[model samples]
Target: MSEIATSEAAHPAHLQHHFDSLQEQSQVASLGMWVFLVTEILFFGGMFTSYLVYRSTYPDAFAIASKHTVILIGAVNTAVLITSSLTMALAVFASSEGNRKSTVNFLTATWVLGFTFLVLKGIEYTIDFHEHLVPGAGFQMAGTNPGHAELFFSLYFIMTGIHALHMIIGLSVLLVILYMARRGDFSPEYHSPVEVMGLYWHFVDIIWIFLFPLLYLIDRHR
Candidate 1:
């Protein structure tokens, strides 16, 4: 019992006693994160399924409502998110290389880009509200299917609102990770947190990628 206890103590500070090795600890952490993300996927998947059903049922209304969306802002936000993903990926790479300075710099860039995306989204929402695009008693649309248009806007707000909430959570996590990086919490052998965060960031960005075209470019060629 003493030998076992001493052996555990001899391990690195980051390696928990429950984990036999650093590699094992990293694998466990990664598996846990993946499981959590899968649950998130199912949550988002239900919304997607609903969107498809409603769009198919009210194709014209959906298309017209989509046109009211601010395509320019949506496009710009997509670019910002894509850029942030790049920076996040670089941050993960830097952390795994034991380059603390580079990791902090990349993380900072990612956070800034993410903030820009949220700001643009806020402006877009403000424009929607001013234009009476929000689905409610004041919702206005000059079409035969105003009710259907309202439904489209309802889905729009629900889906994007949830996505924005996820972004807020992600930003909070990034802030903590950034502080940890500044304190030299990560090293080549122990960067699972960074890697796991990269997965989540990429997932959020991909969700937006799908949303941009669906909400802003529906039947635009018409």
Candidate 2:
């Protein structure tokens, strides 16, 4: 239609040349992000499957290992991540509303919270190291199931280590977004980057949601 054509002709700076309109560009970006997320899910899925297999085989050892985890630290990090997700959502919302200052503020808050989560995770890792829970030489778990307990720690490190890597990458992405936001790069008509980053952040947060209960709360009811 002529109206659509006219709108396309007024394309925002963010619109790529390959895309005919901003809406189309945004849709494509969203689809791409979703596809990437699917791959991420599959990647983590393999780890989760391994965990389930081992956990079923060694439920008692797994429970004992889980008991050794720092529950308070895990709980605190969960809260921190959840709060960061909220700030991320607000950042996306602010970008969509063309509120530059608000966008920067929210993104900065999200970044800080994310950093806090990582710091807490580092503290937990230090405790794990001192407790000899690192899944290799110097590893120490008592009782008759030390081997199975080692397996539990193995999976725990792989899972949480991968999650921490993701957090690091997410923090880097936030830095870029924050810089762009400060430069007034996003607007009501063009905020795909913010939106996609928000999606990634939320996905990471959801992973932690699953992880917290699995890794830290397994033996709590007992």
Quote the lDDT for 11 in model 1.
67
Compute each candidate's TM-score over C-alphas: 0.95, 0.94
**Residue pair clashes in candidate 2:** none
**Per-residue alpha-carbon lDDT of candidate 2 for residues 101-175, written as tens digits (9 for 90 to 100):** 999999999999999999999999999999999977899988748899999899999999999999999999899
Off by over 4 Å in 1: 1-10
Give candidates' CA RMSD values in order.
2.5, 3.4
As a whole number from 0 to 100, the lDDT of residue 92 in candidate 2 is: 94
Tens-place lDDT per residue, model 1, 1-222, is 113445544767677767789899999988998899899899999999999999999999898888899989999999999999999999999999999999999999999999999999999999999999998899999974999999999999999999999999999999999999999999998999999999999999989998888888867776
Candidates in order have lDDT scores of: 0.92, 0.92
Error of 1 at 111 (Å): 0.6
